[model samples]
Target: MIHTNTAMKTQYHPISILFHWLVVVLLIAAFVVIELKGQFPKGSEARELTKTIHGFIGQIIFVIMVLRLFARILFGAPEPKNPSQALAMLSKVMHWLLYAILLIAPIFGILYFQYAGKEIHFFGFTWPQLVTPDPVMKKSVENIHELLGNSLYFLIGIHALAALWHHYFLKDDVLTRILPKMKGVRN
Candidate 1:
């Protein structure tokens, strides 16, 4: 049986770890495609193709994130140890913020897609439209959606930096608590 104790164990399930890392990689790829590839000439096939690819990957992340959230509540997360009250609250609030953004960003993106009179397809499977086209609404939604995504990058950066801080400065088990278990460690 996988033990849930924080003092002894240093990680979550292997499956959860797998999903976490996969999402990280996918998020990086999606971000790069959207923000870093804008130097290419307009009307280029490559630019359009990258946008489609980014959209498809974003859709995939949306599905996985919902699954991850469900798993968190169903299985329950490990408890923290002797954390300062403020730090504990910070953790909880930051986590919920991340979850809220993850859920909202994709929905907004899909709404923008429909509003702009485009069909959203996930790996060639057509996703149903959530809203009809309206040029003004489309522009507004798309702009805010893009802004939220940019905001996510900074939030994610803070999360990463916090993890590193716990790992190196505090020398706490916070980082290890989510790391993959070593072969000899009891699960």
Candidate 2:
């Protein structure tokens, strides 16, 4: 499937699809792990384990996002399946917002963790402290962090709905284009 020309891609670059699914799985894992934290006592080992895993996954997501951004810049995207300019513009805006959110959310987590005077460890590696402790700033950043993180539910829902509409209603190639092994639908 190697081609000399980038535009010859029938769908997204294979690497792009890989990054997309990896981030999706990681994001889901982070959300589920965070939700389960409440089941454990605040100071219990289980709670700490859950938080550690969630934060680690957040960092992983951030790394993957950086790579994904570079891939997008270097490889570019497959041509849009939608024909309407208005629809295309809307899609672009949604995607930009998604990227912005994804990039910012993890940064917020790291900053909040540091500001809260907690060690930010990911995997076996320790993250460098980026800010000094400040309770007021910590509270504010955590609130914004929580707000942006929660907003993902709505934003992702819209993205999924749009893809579904394109696939089932408009019967276009929008969804299939990003799917790793799915064949793009012919017009």
Candidate 3:
């Protein structure tokens, strides 16, 4: 059984909201840079530069995800405004899946670079090539990274749609929970 309560209004911590939107922006940048890289011919400097920028963005995302996880633990989220048991369960599963992908995808990207025996240059520093060059392993890890990267599109779309569904169809505060509060605006 479930009941909708319009009076219940709780929002996420301000810091949590910042981190959430920051990650979203970073993810968009990452995708854009990688896609833009394809416009440049292979082996061109512009292509490599975009790839490096994408890597830097990925690294930043990984660090923020770690912080976000800690913030989530320390400052737990508000309960959904009157969700059914099934909706609550589904929300939890979706969130955990998103967290797993955000955390693990970067590691796989790093491993791909390592397996390819390439140094990751970030802001004048270089990451050591931790793994010996193995063409076979490099290709395998690249495939995995690509698969995870592609899955993000589907997962993010569903997440966004679910939030919209809650906001418009269910008339719930689910979307506004993570949105920043504005003056003279009611969430």
Give the alpha carbon lDDT tens digit for every residue of 6-66 in model 1: 3444456566666677788888999888874596677688877777788788888888888
In terms of lDDT, the poorest run of 10 residues in model 2 is 1-10
lDDT per residue for candidate 3 within 39-93, as digits (tens), equals 9999899998997788889999999999998877767777654368888878778
Q: How high is the lDDT of residue 80 in model 1? A: 54
Model 2 collision count: 0
Candidates, ranked, TM-score: 3, 2, 1
Q: Model 2: per-residue lDDT, tens digit, 5-86? A: 6455567778888999999999899999999999999899999899778888989999999999888877777655566988
lDDT of each: 0.78, 0.85, 0.85
Clash pairs, model 3 backbone? none
Off-target runs (Cα >4 Å) in candidate 1 are 1-10, 184-187
